[model samples]
Target: MSGFSIVNGIAEITDPAIYENWLDNEEFKAAVAADSSPERNAVKRLLIDFEADLARMVRDDRVQEQVVEVMTKYAAWDYVQHDPNAAGNGLEKLIEHFRNVPVVGEVSPPVVSVILDGEVACLMMRKPVPDPVVPDTTYEWNILTVFRVHNGKLAEHWSTFRKAVPGRDPLGD
Candidate 1:
């Protein structure tokens, strides 16, 4: 097991593995859009795409062109990050932060649910954390990240995360 599974896409946010998963899976998309309007639905899709893009960058080379491409597609140039542990504001700071990190061995942490209101979207994730008291044991920690979107691109971000030890990024960095 890769310690990751989509849970049959409970909230229907997991995109497919190798194909145009979301677009071809009408039933799955409908599950996600079941109680939403067209506008809110669009925001939901954008957030999912952004999440998947970040995950892809993790599995691939962090310094490769994909970083810029993915960020450009989903983030505004004046992106603001509010994570206290993050180095500084602006997109490059965030990009540079991951440039030299070793390749991660696990997949991105699964997102439990996604919520959207107006122009703000929140991705709720149940993170896996090593149990401090019990060696080799892990626990699930709930983490919430909210983003303010502009023109369908993420502009500002806030996350519930603290710095981890070097090479110990729980979400695969």
Candidate 2:
């Protein structure tokens, strides 16, 4: 017979670092680099860059350099955005978007879900929500981001947002 135990109705994670390592691994990194479409690569870079920032939030802040680099790349891209916030090739809008996005000072790791179709990759992240009024507090959110790569750099990206409720409850319920 197999032994079983649960704490707070959740199984204790014996290897919590597994997910973290996977997110920061070379496999994902290589995939981002291999994305041939400029737009697609850009999207991958944004996430990669953000991943560093996120890790820093939980462990160290020096990773901001990588985040800045990613942001800079996004700023330089001359691509159209499907998001409503994006107006005219998106750099200014993206900057404004990040400025307005609330950042939790506390660690709130994201849960990533990936799906690939040909050259398009879709990544879904579920994490503590950003406070509606504060930039340093936590909330919950479900975000779906799509990227299309064409020559190693990102060429396009689109995102959808949903709010998350507390208590292990699923969002959109």
Candidate 3:
């Protein structure tokens, strides 16, 4: 048996191997299955669809018709009501940004998780960071994007980033 510690009433697995194994355990499956909320399920499906669209874009290195399809199906037309970041204000602007901006480095597969009982969802991943000073040394950028869901569609989005750091506690110091 692996040891775990309770931190602020949440179980913290002490070992990576144990944690990985526990992901496939029956109890874990049961717990996941017990969450039967329709909204939660819809969000999960939407996230999956979005991830597939992202994968296609990354793989093809271009935003195609499928990207628009996914966006139209999973995200609201006016996703962000008011935002300084031009890319997030509307679906058309976002697609334009995707087409114009060059992805800096290899994008890792995203890990999607639910938050706030289907009201919010998060996609966490890391990507290689370009280092101008030390080109040889590898660096990674940690990114977490949260989306607010409304009527089974993505209504709002926000993101946070940490550059070239590993094991930097995302929860804060």
Candidate 4:
């Protein structure tokens, strides 16, 4: 645990505003891209072209069209999904599932950081859920998502999501 970093602990904005555009954060991108290996580069591309773009798609509700192109480019159609709340485990399912979601324009979810370990890459994000006891107040939770790169495409995915009581704190705090 010596190397583990904490986010959303002191405040809701533990991550800097630049992280919201991580791909464009030159220093952050340079630090990660220093490796320059094939697999690492592929994972970086996937993060930028697919995952980063996902925010835009969500904001505009362009789930079906743009998401398809990027998902197809970076992720395997048959990729394994470990999150219990995930829609399904295929490219088509990803598109179909998001199409039904409501558009939230550039609310700028906090993407804390991303790290790579061989074939696996982890994207850390800070999510805020409404405080159950205090209306208009909220608390933050760290969400870690891991993606495994295979054959230069995202082959598997996992996340820190769990079922919580209705209108309650997601972490049951």
Give the best candidate by TM-score. 1
**Each candidate: RMSD to true structure?**
5.9, 10.2, 8.7, 6.3
lDDT of 2 by residue, 1-173 (tens): 01212233222223445335534545434443335566545555555555545455334343333444555553345544665444335555555444443344434344344445665767655455558799788664656777665445455667563433322212233
Steric clash pairs (candidate 3): none
Where in model 4 is the C-alpha error above 4 Å?
Answer: 1-28, 31-38, 108-110, 127-141, 163-173
Q: What tens digits encode model 1's per-residue C-alpha lDDT throughout 48-103? A: 66776676676655546677777778878788988665657777866665564556
User: Can you give the lDDT of residue 125 in candidate 3?
Assistant: 39
List candidate 3 stretches off by more than 4 Å. 1-34, 81-85, 103-107, 126-142, 161-173
Model 1 segments more than 4 A misplaced: 1-30, 33-35, 100-102, 127-140, 164-173
Per-candidate TM-scores read: 0.68, 0.47, 0.56, 0.65
lDDT for 13 (candidate 1): 35
lDDT of 3 by residue, 51-104 (tens): 555655645566554567657877788887332333457788766645653443
Q: Order the candidate numbers by lDDT, best to worst.
A: 1, 4, 3, 2
Whole-structure CA lDDT of model 3: 0.52
Q: Which 10 successive residues of model 3 have the least lDDT summed? A: 164-173
Error of 3 at 130 (Å): 12
